[model samples]
Target chain A: AQSVSQHNHHVILSEAASLELGCNYSYGGTVNLFWYVQYPGQHLQLLLKYFSGDPLVKGIKGFEAEFIKSKFSFNLRKPSVQWSDTAEYFCALSGGGNKLTFGTGTQLKVEL
Target chain B: EAGVAQSPRYKIIEKRQSVAFWCNPISGHATLYWYQQILGQGPKLLIQFQNNGVVDDSQLPKDRFSAERLKGVDSTLKIQPAKLEDSAVYLCASSLVAGGHNEQFFGPGTRLTVL
Candidate 1:
């Protein structure tokens, strides 16, 4: 079965620290990748998405993700983080269907 | 550009009880989805609807769960004789279409706790 894997369960970082959340999918076909963020008590919001074109895609809130087809990886990255960036991030994949398979989310805590 | 809307932010029920969730998708959206998000896990798709028609429901527990999208605008999901394992957040999301690149706008989910 196709699945998504998010390597980190919990991550703690100081403000202005660089962040990278690893995501890998187990599908070989054409896939659509997405990163969603959920702040405390807030609904999940789309951060970035990758479809066809360039491997690197930028999204709202200064978030970006790179889709590498060879490794089946779409890793999220941010050069600097803020305290308000504390949230739970989810990696999802959609291939050949409208359904999305999501990974166990990564909880990030940013310290001041 | 209003986002999706869901009612009853939270609910607590005992096992064997029945509960229903309501969702109103964004205007002009043709595709709506319901997902189950267990604590500490990512959201899992339960059903998908397109213009009041069922598109995909392979993951839905049809034995105990039922859903409907009347007029293709508002939808309801019901679980009869809910089990303890049914406790999870039910999320409603809508997209303009079922395409791969269409962004899905989500609503604040209804959290259900089955004791």
Candidate 2:
């Protein structure tokens, strides 16, 4: 069965630190990738998405993800993190269907 | 534009009891989705609707779970004889289009606790 894997379960970092959350999916062929963030007490919102474009895609809130098709990976990156960036992040893939499959979330804790 | 809306922010019920959750998608949205998020896990898609018709429900446990989208705007998800494993956050989302690139907008989920 197709699945998504998130390498980090939880991460802690000080403010202004660079961040990278790993995401990989088990699928061959075409796929649509997405990154979503859920802040404390807020609903999940789309941070970015990738679909038949340049491998590198930029998203809201200074977030970006690189879709490496060879590795089946789409890793999220942020050059500088703020305390407000602390939240749960999820990676998802939509392929050939209406429903999307999500990876286990990564919880990032940014300390000031 | 208003995001998706869900009712009964929380629900608790005894095992074997039946319960239902409601959702209202954004105006002009052509697609709606329901997802189940267990503690410490990613949200899993349970159903997808295009207008009043279901587009995909392959992951839904049809044995006991049922959902409906009336008037192609609002929806309801029901579970008969709820089980303990059903305890989780039920999320509702909607998108303007059904194509692969459309991003979904989510609502505040209904946290269900099946005791």
Candidate 3:
């Protein structure tokens, strides 16, 4: 079955530091990738998505993800992190239908 | 437009009890979805509905779980004789269309604790 994997279980960084979260999927066929973020006590919100066109997609809050089809990976990145960016990040993949397979998730703690 | 709405922000039920969650999708959305989010894990799709019709429910445990989207607007997911493993946050999401590319909007979710 198709599955998503997030390598980092928890990551801690100081404000203004660079950030990268690794995500990989098992499927080899065409896929739609997404990055979702959940702040403490808030609902899950879309960070970025890759459907077609360019492989690098930028999302709200200065977040971006690179979809590497050869590696079956979509890694999320931010040039500089903020205290407000402390949240749980999830990587998800949908092959064709409305159903999505999500990764285990990564908890990012941005220190002061 | 309003985002997805889910009722009963939290629920606590003993094992073998029953529980139900309600969700109201955003207006004009044709796709509704239910997901189970366990602690420290990503959300898992439990079922999907295209309007009032079921699109996919292969992951749903049909013996104990049931969901319906009557009138193609509001939806309900029920768990009968809930088990300890059923303790998780139930999230409701909706999208403009039923395809894979459309972005999905999620609600606050209903946290269910099966004791």
Clashing pairs in 1: none
Which candidate ranks first by lDDT, i.e. highest?
Answer: 3
DockQ score of each predicted structure, in the order shown: 0.83, 0.82, 0.90
**Which ranges in model 1 have alpha carbons more than 4 Å from their true place?**
none
TM-score of chain B of 3: 0.98
Candidate 2 lDDT, tens digit per residue, A2-61? 678999999999999999999999876689999999999999999999998799999999
Among all windows of ten consecutive residues in candidate 3 chain A, which has the lowest summed lDDT? A93-102
Q: What TM-score quantifies how close candidate 1 is to the native fold?
A: 0.98
Q: Global lDDT for candidate 3?
A: 0.95
Q: Give model 2's TM-score versus the native structure.
A: 0.97
**Candidate 3: DockQ?**
0.90
lDDT of candidates 1 onward, in order? 0.94, 0.94, 0.95
In angstroms, what RMSD does candidate 3 have relative to the true structure? 0.7
**Clash list (residue pairs), candidate 3:** none
